[model samples]
Target: MPEKPPAIESFKESTKSPESELSPEVLEKVMNKVQDINEAGVAYSFVSGGPYSAGSIFEQDNLQKTKLVRILKEGLLGTPEKFYLEGVPPTKEQWAKEAQVSLRKGGRSNVYFNVTGMAHEEETPNTQSGETWISKSAGSSKKNALAFIFDLSKFTYDDDTNKMSRKYYETYYKRSTRKFTTAYGFNLSHRVPPRFFNGILLKLQDNYQYDQLAAEIGILSEQVYKEKGNLLLPIYDVYGNLYWPKKMSYEEVKKFVEERDKNKE
Candidate 1:
């Protein structure tokens, strides 16, 4: 039997009204920070499944200076003036403490930009899911209250398919529940292009590569929200059920998948 949809209480409606608007000047600064990190590319390690293991986990440090943390602090936390004027910027020690807090709470308390790295298992053949969301609470007046949900994936050099592995997709989809849903939120899946990971599997640091990656993300962002284009990706509900792109139910999706698999057999 198929699983039931999650209760409404599990996934609360996102906060209405922008927390704070970003001026043109501040918006530019924030984009620049995002571009910088995209260009730098994050450092990560493959655990459990090795390079080709669809179930492998990608692990990275969430330190104050790391790409993830830095992006959150500088980009979403507001400009230097805002931080300085309000109070001293959070120190490395402070960020470390907040990271723990954020992890425990499942999201940041004050800011709406949440970065989550979820690893399901400890043993071999594990899968890791990394998600970044700029919720309505981030303060954008855009029509879609929720800015976007970024699903991060790594691309390997030897993998010529240029597609996410089926196993990984299933794992990610199954694991996303309860805290994952948002009303009218756009879902954007990003696979770091192979160029950034060629030769060196650990870190990507070429200025040109970073620019390209950042541009790709920017283009995708525009395509989905700016132009209001449709990518035909399914939106998931709190129960990890398909909530959009027809059927509007997880059982329908399951039946469809089963039928397709049967046809192939």
Candidate 2:
């Protein structure tokens, strides 16, 4: 027999909604609405010369200080004069500083949390590890964590069914994308809160090349919640080993950890 679905109690405190006490049948209704949604591109960061290679974890002596960094900080955190950043936002500055340090010997790698909101035109084609991704977003369209939060807020869910309409998704895309534009502030009311996204962003800040891990956890968490009205596993898994974030499986994770430990020994 397969593993049973995980319980929702683990994630309920984080979700912080009365709606979280949803029945499996109701949660399934919500899953049907969101199952097909996906993002189009990968997120990344540039080191001293260019993009970091895969599996080569290292620390830099200084922040990369690219345009994407500035834009993300400003877009999500807001200007000091306008509004102070509330809740647990990702410490991009600190994250950059730490990522610049030498972690392990080099091979090939990717960043955990990439510059989220970048226009399709801003990215270069045929890019590879260690090569620079040109960011011409002097004034370009981009989606930050804030934009996603705002998008989630727009669509109201039915109290009983817990689902939204296709028309809402169409509007969300319209608001999230545009040429030479940036999303600044949209007063968030309810639905998914900022802390939810902040948790993911902060987690992303710590790892190297785990965007899929975050994405998968978010999707799976929601799917499981809807199907069983609970979480199936901790995002980091029971052993505190991050297999999915590295895009691996349980057996593969066991082998990888054993090999790593054997090498260390």
Candidate 3:
């Protein structure tokens, strides 16, 4: 482990608000649920930003960085995997369509999956400039491996109003208040297999602003967990190294997260 960064240290101090600011009952309930899941023998892993048009793990804002650290302290284990997309940016409509498909399939579809390969440069006639147009082919063939994919459409400000289903909060949290203000949403991408699934630590941008920690922490209570019975929470470290069940057992990973938290304290 490396030294905790100064920005994260500042974040820790700043987040120490009085508990009375929020509903203590709700806070305690969320904490209890989190404790129960942590002891339920569920496996855990970390996933940073996945295939986004903007921002990488290393370039995350303070809020995002703080959220990653806070979740790690809460007990998620392993190095965080950093995912990125290649080629031209997709339109908002395209992303919305993909989100619908991802929700329907309960994971990422193969349409978004990218295989490792090299970029091929090519030139063509430019009608406007009367010069050769240069561009690189999106597909590659150097190496064949799985790259993590997530629905970026949900994260954009345009989708903030209608994208996040209020039914989730109404059913799980039992609160009608729209806790999430920003368009940001969080979840495990389709990259993780079904067998090793545990749970997800979901958070939106305005989630922290409203200090809706309980709603954010209540992801395990979702219906998907009931159906799957195995959903691993994806986490990310400051260094952005990805970890999964293939590299460590659930017990080992859990212990690692707990120990790391203790040391930080």
Point to the candidate with the largest TM-score.
2
**Best-to-worst lDDT order:** 2, 3, 1
Expressed as tens digits, the lDDT of each residue in 190-260 for candidate 2 is 11222222111211222333334344444534443444432222223211222222323333444655666
| Tens-digit lDDT string for candidate 3 (1-265) | 1121112222233433333333454334322222112221122222333342112222435333343333333322111121123322223344446556555654332222111111112322222331111001121111111122222222222233234342211111122222221112122222233332233322222212212332232232232334432233332211111122111223344455577557658
Candidate 1 achieves a global lDDT of: 0.26
**lDDT per model, in order?**
0.26, 0.27, 0.26
Clashing pairs in 1: 39-210
TM-score, per-candidate, Cα-based: 0.23, 0.25, 0.24
Positional deviation of residue 171's Cα in model 3 after best superposition, in angstroms: 26
Weakest 10 consecutive residues of candidate 1 by summed lDDT: 123-132
Give lDDT for model 2: 0.27
lDDT of 2 at 234: 22
Total clashes for model 2? 14
lDDT value, candidate 3, whole model: 0.26
- Of the two candidates 1 and 3, the one with more favorable TM-score, higher being better, is 3
The true-versus-predicted C-alpha distance at residue 192 of model 2, in Å, is 1.5
TM-score of 2: 0.25
Give residue 124's lDDT in candidate 2 (0 to 100): 32
